[model samples]
Target chain A: MRITCPHCGERDHREFYYKGHALALERPSPDAGEAAWDDYVHQRENPAGVTRDLWYHEGGCGAWVVVSRNTLTHEVLGTQAASEARA
Target chain B: MGNLVAKSPCKGLLPLSVGAMSASEVETGAMTMLSPRKGQDGALDEAMRAVHGLGYPAPSGVESAGEARAIWFGHSSVLLVGAEPGQRLEEHGVLVDQSDAWAVVRLDGPGAEDVLARLVPVDVRLCAFPVGSTARSKIGHMSGSVTRVGEASFWLMVFRSMAETLVHDLKSAMEAVAARG
Candidate 1:
């Protein structure tokens, strides 16, 4: 998939790194205890079709990007900052 | 070594720390990372814009932290050339010391564009890929970004581990182009 890094020009997909899931996991507040943060850190729905994923351009600038893609085809639907996606 | 083989474009002098490596036959070159303050988009952008405004064409893409054209070398690193003179990191973003962690290479030659054509899907024809533009795509299974540096020269950012693989493919492609001629 060709990603036009708002910073670097499109090169090859190998330049960037794949960081799964762009949406930050929500954990219960401090009082929520271990189960909360544990689920947040370890659990992920690995859904197919349309999904929000985190991808880091490890090969390029190394920015964490929130990219929406199709799990089946690996087609990148759109990409933005992970922070913006949550908002 | 004291004299800048190529004067610093933005800074009056290339830091003594700044140096370049040349590709044996492919006319390729590499420069170690320097002053790449990661996340410090403000400083990076300001400096790069200053350089661009000074007249050299720098088209930055990272806008959030004010970084416009400088190439993001990787997650925490970026090509400083994209930043300009007045830019500084204190105001915004973060800088990571990525020196020795990765390698930088310049790819150019008479048939450089033709060579890239075999690897990248982007249009490498002079009229399309023209200088100053960049894109993130793939060269085989390896992913990276390509930045136009000169008439036949381009900046290719890849992981250090992949440097040998990339250079080999690039040199092979160049040879193939020459063979086709």
Candidate 2:
């Protein structure tokens, strides 16, 4: 459950806020109409198994991160800063 | 409690008169007016107004107007934990109870996540968790805000009444994790 933050060293779970999923969904254009926007905003596939998620460290440096965890067991497999994860 | 003048025949609190019965006032903390002479930073003030719709009056004797945020710890109190709570918090309209209505719980160390995992379903891993993030969630049945203050520490604001309950739960969970190790 303890994930080491690259900037803040090792921290406990209490300091981090859970942001759902690491997948970045693009917003549909305004011309795409209400249905397209609604579907894009409301519809998402919530898989039950292993997945990557977004979380915020509200207390730390205010950075964004992505975590890979087991859905059923709630075990965090790995975590990476969203910025670092990209590069 | 000058505000108690409206209600007649009050049972709990003392009535608003010289000869009125001295009754215990209802505890209403959480919204502590932590105003310094100086107010919130521009960015934080905007965020407070935009987010929580709060603006507290400046507390006397505080030279620095530290940054403020509109943070909800429970159902009743919306804490403005800084010099100024928020830009929109009406100082006059809303009652600001400067009493100690909340208990701040700081959770740090590597075992902190392991401790919280016992109750909170959300993952507390760093890679996914970002700093300056806030969540309205339940920690051991008490609904409150879990604000990440450090890479390893988070500040939990809970009702004073449930302070013992939360601490007990947190300790139990930590012990369980240690036992597993």
Candidate 3:
């Protein structure tokens, strides 16, 4: 897997570490119920199709990237800086 | 500051000359890491320009004016080498002293690229890396900041704690490249 870091350009996948789903960036509200918090904290959907995930470019640009990829084929569709994704 | 005795992180192991390539520790007088405060990039740029006659470099690029060189490290951050020590841009963002945090080394010679290709995964070819281009990349399992300072020279900065490891890795790679010649 190759990643095109926005800052560092294209680099090998060994430079990055998959940090799970991009949804992890959204946290549950402080006053939300236990079930809501539990679902937010522990629940994960094993979608085999296109999924948006987060990856850390630890060895490259140190940028948190949101990668759009297919879980089944492992084909990366696209990527963008996570900060820009949040914006 | 006058009481502090400067020390090279690589000690006496650097300034190595081997075959067509040579490696030496670079004495960067003063260095600072600058990060613009949220929504204050314009202000930071203006201030930096006033100080150094140049603004922060673009991604993977370098900007220099007089004795100061600004190399882009990541988004909205730059490493300013030769910046006046104790200088601060408090109103614009954060300024931290980085002179003692990194080990700066220079590798130059016709075969410098050959040696680097054996270690780093980045494309160090003259056409790819070009002079003034910089990148944060890994060198033998260690994170490092690499910048092309000249047509045949590169400056590499790694954590101070990893200086010895970097020297070992560089020597091994240089030796292998020389042996193959």
Best by DockQ: 3
What lDDT is reached at residue A13 by model 3? 89
TM-score of chain A of each: 0.71, 0.71, 0.91
Interface RMSD of 1: 4.5
TM-score of chain A, cand. 2 = 0.71
Which is better, 2 or 3, measured by TM-score?
A: 3
Clashing pairs in 3: none
Docking class of 3: medium
Top model number, lDDT: 3
Under CAPRI classification, how is model 2 graded? Answer: incorrect
Residue runs of model 2 more than 4 Å from their true location after superposition: A1-87, B1-78, B84-95
lDDT of 1 by residue, B64-178 (tens): 2233234534434444443333433434444443333343456666677777888876676668766666655566456766767667777665555776676667666766677
Q: TM-scores, in order shown?
A: 0.58, 0.41, 0.95
Question: For residue A26, what is the lDDT in candidate 1?
Answer: 42
Give the per-residue lDDT of model 2 (tens digit) for A1-87: 765554444556676788776755345777999898887778776888898878775544356777888888888787777767876
Docking band of candidate 1? acceptable
